[model samples]
Target chain A: MYITWMLAEGHTYKQMLPTTPGVFMGEMIVVTVVGADKPGIVAAISSVLAEAKANIVDISMTVLRGFFSMIMVVDISGAVTDLTDLRDRLERKGDEVGVKVMVLHEDVFRYMQKI
Target chain B: MTKYDASELAEIIEMLSFQHLDIRAVTMGINITGALRYDDLGEGVREIVEKHARGLRDAVKEVSSKLGVQIVTKRVAVTPVSVLLDAKAGDLNEAVRLGVSVAEALDSAAADLGVDYVGGYAAFVESGYSLGDRGVMESIPEALSSTERVTAMVNAASTLSGINMDAVYEMGSIVKETANLTGGRGCTRLGVFANAPEGTPFVPGAYHGRGEEDPVINVAVSGPGVIENVVRSLEDADLRTLHDAMKRAAFKVTRLGELVGREVANRLGVKFGSVDLSLAPSPAVGDSVADVLRAMGVEEPGAPGSVLALAVLTDAVKKGGAMATSSVGGLSGAFIPVSEDLGMAEAVRKGSLTLSSLEAMAAVCSTGLDMIVLPGDVEEHVIAAIIGDVMALGIVLDKSLGVRLIPVPGAREGDEVDFGGLLGKAPVMPVGRFSSKALVMRGGVVPPTVSRLMKG
Candidate 1:
């Protein structure tokens, strides 16, 4: 039940990273969220994704140690702007809500895989 | 005669085609010796099983979670319980009691840790036997009938030890009886083998091998979703393009698994086993090995569904894993654990799938007759035949595969084994009612054939 709440609150995601070395066909992005419990965490972040023209492919969310943790898989093939701008905007919102948000290129996963 | 047949000079024209996966589990080793801890005369066996199950659950979760992927199962295969229960083997009732305790401990541990399936309740007697081995094998019917989570395996022969004809003869009857007693779950819970490995992490076939120490870290990676996505992504791409795409994704999946695995191993301080990038499936709405097939534009996953899919998927995964790390092994193909897969389970529940259908899937999969939930009270001889069929395939194909049949207690046709979490809960399927007792009883030795030498 609380899992529902954390998911509802913002979550983490991978923005479609630009297809670079060690990456697959599509642009991939990963987003991660860690913070004190709150509501609409996902709604808030997904709204940002909507603004950035990304599609969600997979998602996982949970609450641990009274902190909300979530991971989102997104496609930025259709994004209107680069993720850096989006990352800046998300950090601003996260700071306002006292939530910690991180936006990573999907290559981070690719980078991780190479090791 | 055509050169292809007579002279054998015709080059084998191979074409890369469909790319999809159906099987999701490649658990190769599960040590069951936890039940034999004799510090207090085996008083700590249950605790050990509990610890083993919990540790596996925790480790599987820690690694999978770190990778941002949903692991389909957190299973453990242990050493056979019979060798350790020699003192208690004579009493079937006592053997059953211990089996029940271990099952309960596993279930309880999984429940507490919020992980899924915990296996490793078995006995192996491929060559000689012990009092405990006989006891555990005898109690299989009752033990399997009573447990919701436990899995079992019996090795009657192997390359190391010549086939135990006597043990094979008895096992045939026992398999059928277990099927009958458990209403057929035993058909899926039971597995017989010639040369079973020591570190298998999957079940119905997992038993402690001599090399296993305490418990070690092993990772089974499933990417049917990834595979399916790749197949769809390359619909218009040529075979080379499709294979390339698969290789690229497989590389990422395996890399992610390696990263997570190394971390878990470092934390546990145990040597890490291979990263099995088996395209495992889930029972979720859209997750299935069959779904993978459908994505390849094949309406069904059957004979003539294109035999090349297996080789293609295998090659792609190997390339990816190779780039990820130098160390890799285990049943690293597509998994098709029947009851554990949502699509197959649902198909069985709907009556569109059958045992032969499973066998067809097994031909190209990592293992055969996996986690198949069957009706209770199935005949044991039938179970023996199922095991024999898979064992024969293993010998003939020279590939590693085993059966993990579950004879759900109190279950009948249409009943479900609700083992929530990674095992995903599956409905029981029906098997042939006729007994294979005569054939099983005639078991001399399934002499190892040259097929067993397949290095692939």
Candidate 2:
């Protein structure tokens, strides 16, 4: 089924729903993780997203100047928790994994980089 | 998903986390003209301002958190109170009393609504003063001293209208009286301007002019530290290359400001006014325009090459910012407030930056003679002459300039006076030894520039 959401600009966007109960739709977010390379870093981050039902649409990982860095574009439409809660959970997970995580809305990138 | 390179993402993060990239102010310009229809002027102003500004702080917070950007201050600017009081007050005393009442209303509403400041307690008397203008001038010391969040400004000169030496002379004493009342702290919230723009987001000079929407969102972008970082990154780069780098950094910063401003306006259901590109600096280290000048190869802020360096920096910022957003207004240049900038205060302490040099630098930059502390015993005519000099520049150059001077009561030259918080602290700078009393005493009007004769 198609579901419509009111965007910040007052425009309506339609998304196809999975017909599963309690699944909702929301905005896109960018999660950036940076720190030293270590074991189970990806697992720890992805596990928190999995718990919140946030889908990782795209991700790129690299090491610059001997420090590990990862960028993930997340679709939080179906997340069980709000952006703030999810950010806190991911930050806590990043702390446990010895990294720094930043959560920002996707529009910050689109508006700043495009045109 | 929207496509952005990982490197671009990293640059954005670095700018925000380390370079002090943020919106300095999101000022909502609200028209309170309709308040005149009510019988009780103060109550009417309170109602209208409260209705408009109620959601400003919350809306700003919401957008700041959603975008992960820091919005430092949420403020409101209303229509000039003098315009509202023109027909309301019958005598000068009534005008002063009514002005204070309205100021109190604005102050209480701002306090309750969580707005940091409310501007537009002002009068525009470039040519001459109406009863309302005189009233606002007389009440300024009292209004500002009594209210915590109210700011006042006077536009006594403009390019087309010439300089109003009478108003300028009056403002000098108004500033002094305000200093006497508030230990010079009240003067910090006051400004005297030439060719004051209508859509400024900065405090003490912001106002909702006649052609503006009833409610609009105007944003001021501050990134002196970000520009300084870009300048420092280029080691031994030529001036041309330095300009290009600063321009590129300014483009990114302006883009961020426009984005945040539009989002906040959209949420508040108000028209987006403009994005000011002024590189406003704070008291914090690394966030100073003077430091940017120093990084540009000048030994100090007021060194020999300082004017050239400042002109280049201001031009590059304007060019890049113009490309980023079409709706640019306000004082879109670098603010060199001595007390508000650590580097500038340091320059004064080191005896490298004098008032004469600062005046020369003001001819090239924006916001003339801002946040400068003068000796308490200095004559009023000296302040008038200083303001008149800056006004002359504005008219001749056809640009916007403002003077915000604080004459600290009982403070001597070279004495450090701390206003604390974002107002910062600076040592009182010495003025000219000789008197300009005769020059200022011949008060009438300085004629408009010869450029006014030119036709389009």
Predicted structure with the largest lDDT when compared to the true one = 2
Q: Write the per-residue lDDT of candidate 2 for residues B1-456, one digit (tens) a residue.
A: 446678877777777777778899999999998888899898999999989878898899889878888999989999999998897999999899999999999999999999999999999999999888988999999999999999999999999989999999988899999999999999999999999998999989899989888899999988999899889989789989999999988888899889988999999998999999999899988789999999999998888999999999999999889999998989998889999999999999999999889999999888999999999987788899999999999999998999999999999999999988888999999997887889988999999988666623
Error of 1 at B452 (Å): 6.3
Residue B362 lDDT in model 2?
92
Q: How would you encode candidate 2's per-residue C-alpha lDDT over A38-68 as one tens digit per residue?
A: 8878777877876787766556766533477
Chain A only: TM-score of every candidate? 0.69, 0.73
Q: Candidate 2 recovers what fraction of true contacts?
A: 0.42
Candidate 1 lDDT by residue in tens digits, B1-456: 000111110000000001222223323244545445454423465466555444555565554433334445555555666655665444766665665555555556545655444455566676566667766777666666666556666766554444555665566566667666755544555666646665555556555566765566556655666667668767787767777877877776666556555666665565667666666666665556766666665555544553466556667777876787665655667777665677667666666667777776676777676777766666656666777777666656666666666666568777778665555677777787566677777766666665435432
Model 1 deviation from the true structure expressed as Cα RMSD, one decimal place: 12.0
DockQ each: 0.07, 0.26
What's the iRMSD of model 1?
A: 20.0
Per-model TM against the reference:
0.67, 0.93
Candidate No. with top TM-score: 2
Question: lDDT of candidate 1?
Answer: 0.59
What CAPRI-style quality would you assign to candidate 1? incorrect
Total backbone collisions for each predicted model? 77, 1
